[model samples]
Target: MDPAVTAAALDDEHRTFARLLREHQGIVATVAASYCRDPHDRADLAQEIAAQLWRAWPNYDPARRFSTWMYRIALNVAISAVRSAALRQRHAVPFDERLHDVADPAPRDPQAEQQIRALHAFIQAQAPLDRALLLLYLDDRSHREMAEILGLSETNIATKISRLRQRIRHEL
Candidate 1:
């Protein structure tokens, strides 16, 4: 490929990646929010995921599913971000008490939004990996796909999901 053509192609790929982020912005934001207690950190993590997606775009295999690839990147970013020293300096907003009030209002049905807020509160109280597992499961990713993304066996995914569901039910 010619140098100019390659550059333009790369730019176009980045644009497509940006569009993907826009389309799945809520999913990314939700995943970020689940991991980070601070609203600002969640937004920052979402932006970091977008940036990582852009950086990894050139290598993206067009034959594969875009959303799955994107989900993997988003999950990795969220998990890794939460473990960072810089992220540790930021205190988590208390989940059982005031976090729900601090959450942004949803534009959709109020009942559904309230349910989502309640779920977020529940997930925020779980372990980090458990939170990621629950988020991916809620996103409707299959056990096989979740296994691939989380580096676990399909059976393990099934078991973990079953346990997570029970745990969430118990919490609620």
Candidate 2:
């Protein structure tokens, strides 16, 4: 391939990837936000996930599902970020509790909001991989697809999802 053509092709791929990100921005942000207690940190994590997704785009396999691949990368990045932040906090001096303001939950339609808030709270309390698994399950992904995305056996996916649902119910 000519240098200019290769560059152009790469540019096009980036653009397409950007479009996909924009289309699914809410899903990505919600997943990232659920992992963090700080709003600023959530936004930063979402941006980092987007950047990682862009960097990984060149290696994306066309024969596979794009959303599945993207979810795996985004979830991995977000989970790693949360873990790193938690490690740092563990080593830091404790801050004054009075300095922190409680975050008011977002307003939503009463009936729908109740379920959403319950689910969000459940997700925040779970392990990072469990959170990702619940998110994929809520998104209606099939067991085989979830297995492929998480690099687990289909039977494992089914079992994990069942356990996660029980955990979520317990949290609520």
Candidate 3:
């Protein structure tokens, strides 16, 4: 309970949190990009995700997989951002197309680029929960893992994945 010992422990905790956050930083970026179209919004969402993760760090169980824990927090923050944006936009006027980000003029493979764009469009069109499911699926997460991250049953995850695949095939 000495002050020096307490400071050292706090420093160690901060270091551990930083290391874990760096190790799984991609989860934050991917979730942010998946939910936000604008670059600024994506950065904001990523920051929020990191902050929330740090805030929740003391409760993080070392026995649990860090990536799994990171995904849950990242996805939750992204979903909340999407919901908040939707709520704000509901009563707002539309913006001009000129303000949107412009696409690159030259795609290495036009066909592949088109497909990627179509897939992203499809993902963005989904409801928030479905979007999270698709992101986890695309990331090659197992049904059990997805269920753990999203707080759903493994059976429900499998069923939803099957339905999502059918929808993707039909629509995209």
Candidate 4:
């Protein structure tokens, strides 16, 4: 690709990424909150995910669903952020009682908030891959979408979900 042409394409790709991110802000927020406990860390991870999404936009195929691509990038960035000990050590922040701001506007019940907090605590205890599966499950994604986002076969997604269900049931 010519230098000027490449720059133009990159700019166009970033514009597309920005529009998609706006359309799917909920997905970003969900992934960020599900992956991190600290509010500052969640914000940082969300920003990193957006930056990576923009950089990876040129590789995205227009025929594919943008949400699928965004989920993959967001989850990958989130997973990496959790794995990077140096990053965590350097940017560690205290998590206060106030939960990270979710976009919910409805008057939330105390019981519901407590339940959500409990669920997040349980999810935070799981392995990285398991956390990814639970996040997709919580999002009500179908097996095919989950498989696509996680790069697993549909059968694998089904089996893992079944196990997750069993575990959740046992916990409840």
**Which candidate achieves the best TM-score against the true structure?**
3
Tell me the lDDT of candidate 2.
0.72
TM, every model? 0.79, 0.78, 0.86, 0.81
> For model 4, which pairs clash?
none
Off by over 4 Å in 3: 85-108
lDDT tens digits, residue span 25-83, model 1: 76676677667767677678878988888888878888877877888888888778777
Q: Name the 10 consecutive residues with the lowest summed lDDT in model 1.
A: 93-102
- Measured on C-alpha atoms, candidate 3 has an lDDT of 0.79
3 or 4: which has the higher TM-score?
A: 3
Query: By the TM-score metric, which is better: model 1 or model 4?
Result: 4
lDDT, residue 125, candidate 1: 71
Clashes of each: 0, 0, 0, 0
TM-score, cand. 4 vs. native: 0.81
lDDT of 1: 0.75
- Candidate 2 on 1-172: residue-level lDDT in tens? 7999999997898789888888877567656655655656666777898889888888989898888888888888877876795733632212112121123345557787577556665665667778778878878999988888778999999999888877767776
Q: What lDDT does model 4 reach?
A: 0.79
lDDT of 3 by residue, 36-149 (tens): 666666678789999999999999999999999999989888777767856346322111122222323443577876776687778877888998998899889999899999
Q: What is the lDDT of residue 133 in candidate 2?
A: 86
lDDT of each: 0.75, 0.72, 0.79, 0.79
Q: After superposition, how far is residue 107 of candidate 1 from its true place, in Å?
A: 9.3
After best superposition, candidate 3 residue 68: deviation in angstroms?
A: 0.6
Q: How much is 149 displaced in model 1, in angstroms?
A: 1.7
